[model samples]
Target: MPDVTKAIASDIFSGRYPAGSSLPTENELGVEYGVSRTVIREALKVLAAKGLVLSRPRVGTVVCNEDDWNIIDPQVLAWHAPHALDDKLFDAILET
Candidate 1:
């Protein structure tokens, strides 16, 4: 479950899934990843909890703005560190 979430988060942070983009349906993701919908749902739940995605009942999962992400999440920090290039989150913390 953790691995699945990490991979998806990597895809998002790496620009494979830009903000405002809707993620594939759970069934599609399951097929794409060779997993079950249960796993995809769990992964999506993790993403939603991190504020990286918004999961609506009918709209599926949509990537949220980077500003809304949980900077404290280790995975989120790791993903941002390299992809952000400017280390914006690190700069923010240093400024604080």
Candidate 2:
């Protein structure tokens, strides 16, 4: 479950799942990760708690803006890829 959560977070940090973009449905992610929808659901919850994503009433899980991310969170920092420190992240680091 943690692996799935980290993989999705990595994708987001890598720009593969950009902010304002909706992530695939739980079923789709389940298929892609070979896990059950329940696992995907839990993973999404973790991402949401980290401020990396949010659940919309009509839409599915959507990635939040970079500003909304809890960059100070150790787990979130750990999730970022080695070369993912873009301008926004650099600014975030400076701000902190």
Candidate 3:
């Protein structure tokens, strides 16, 4: 459950699912992760607790804005750290 939560959070940090964008349906995520919908639901709940996402009735889960994120949370910080490398790498490539 923690792994799935981290994976989804990482996706948000990496901009794969930007703020205000709805995540894939639970069914779709279940298929992608090979887990049951219940597991996906729990993972979503965790993300919500972290202020990384919000659940909208009939609309699905949407990522929260950067301002809404619990950036000070240790887990959130750790999950977001790796994504910073992507920007640095891009800058390096552009300078070459």
Candidate 4:
């Protein structure tokens, strides 16, 4: 579950899901991660509370703007920079 959240969070911060872009539906995420819709919603809620995403009815969840991200939070930034050791996503990490 944590891995799924981390992966989704990383993708959002890396601009894979750019600001204003809608995220996959909970059902889609559940299928992708092989988890229940309830788990997907919980993971999304974590991102939402961190201000990395915004969930709206009908519109679905969307990645928030970079300026709205809690970049100063170590945990948040770290979660988005797992590949930092190899510089694989260094540029993307800096972008956030």
On TM-score, the leading prediction is 2
Candidate 1 wrongly placed segments (more than 4 Å): none
Candidate 3 colliding pairs, count:
0
The best-first sequence of candidates by lDDT reads: 2, 3, 1, 4
What tens-digit string does per-residue lDDT give for candidate 2 at 1-96?
Answer: 999999999999888999999999999999999999999999999999999999988888999998898987888988984647778777787898
Candidate 1, pairs of clashing residues = none
lDDT for each residue of candidate 1 in 31-82, tens digit (9 for 90 to 100): 8888999999999998999999999988889999988988767777776677
Better of 1 and 3 by lDDT: 3
Each model's lDDT = 0.86, 0.91, 0.87, 0.81
Query: Which pairs clash in model 4?
Result: none
Measured with C-alpha atoms, the lDDT of residue 53 in candidate 2 is: 99
TM-score, model 3 to reference: 0.85
User: In model 4, which regions exceed 4 Å deviation?
Assistant: 83-96
When 3 and 4 are scored with TM-score, the better candidate is 3
TM-score of each: 0.88, 0.89, 0.85, 0.80
Native-vs-model 1 lDDT?
0.86
RMSD of each: 1.6, 1.4, 6.4, 4.5
Which candidate has the top score in lDDT?
Answer: 2
